[model samples]
Target: MALLAPPKDWYHPAAGAERLWIGIALVWCFVMSLMMPYWHFRGKQNANGTTYTVTPKDYLERTEKFVAANKVGDLNGIPIVQPAPGTDIYLLGRMWNWYPVLKLQKGETYRLHISSMDLQHGFSLQPVNMNFQVVPGYDHVLTLTPTSSGEFTIVCNEFCGIGHSTMIGKMLVE
Candidate 1:
């Protein structure tokens, strides 16, 4: 029997390169699709929803109740209680020194419910982690969490007045 050679076109470098590029593009698309829902839900705004407000006293009382009922000491004083994991929380409060002073576990998640208490103020976290504006009569809710253990500082991002630089808070994650 005579030996036979493969077709020259079978080893064409250009065709091989084209196939590699197509495979990469498909993989990129697949990854983006898998991430779509997370981005969509995170960016979605709660329009036409009621805004809830609570006094510091009311917040403390609610925290106590949550802790007592759940037998969990994880409850802290925000206008809203601890959110279900991966859920957002809407909170309202005036700008003041150390407003939130929030505490959370290492892997816990949180959505900040923030607003001006008396005047327009700024909300900033350091080591430059999160930044937002706190304006009176307007509500701002920021979805965030402390992924690492340590104390992160929250400073005023806006220049409300002389106290702008002095306004600071702490987010402690254990």
Candidate 2:
């Protein structure tokens, strides 16, 4: 078909509306490119890139000790811990569960450390919509200060395993 053949003036320069649209598209692309670094420097909610290498065994031990020291009760089989404000707290993701539901005080900041035991997972806090990746060999720390007092749910956004749909956790802010 004629549509499949080369244009009559294939070597001609683009002009008029075609040139104007091309220039506009280039400007739009440059603006978008600038916005990425602008937001990276200005955004408050971005990840602070604070991660440390940690073995799964060592991380599990630390979590166990933390639970033992601050555990207030047990839900199902998971320990429910109310850690003191301004202290460090641990949340471990493994298999199909998030160990030790955490309770925190509103407006008090805590260094929240998250990691995995077996496979990779996700830490997604609902309503507030903060998300972080949970890797097995690295600890991800988030300086968190819950502004409101309520119960929040944490669901694994990463497809972890067969029971990943059941990998739900809870956080209580008081």
**RMSD (CA, Å), each prediction:** 12.6, 2.3
* TM-score for candidate 2, residues paired by index: 0.85
Question: On residues 1-174, what C-alpha lDDT tens digit does candidate 2 reach at each position?
Answer: 566988777787899999999999999999999988888889656577479999999999999999999999987788999999999999999989898899999999999999999999999998799899999999998888898889888999998889999999998899
Q: Which residue pairs in candidate 1 have backbone atoms (N, alpha carbon, C) closer than 3 angstroms, thus clashing?
A: 91-113, 94-116, 94-117, 95-117, 122-157, 122-158
Q: Evaluated with TM-score, which candidate comes out highest?
A: 2
Per-residue lDDT for 78 in model 2? 88
lDDT of 1 by residue, 55-91 (tens): 5555445444543443323323432133355655333
Clashing pairs in 2: none
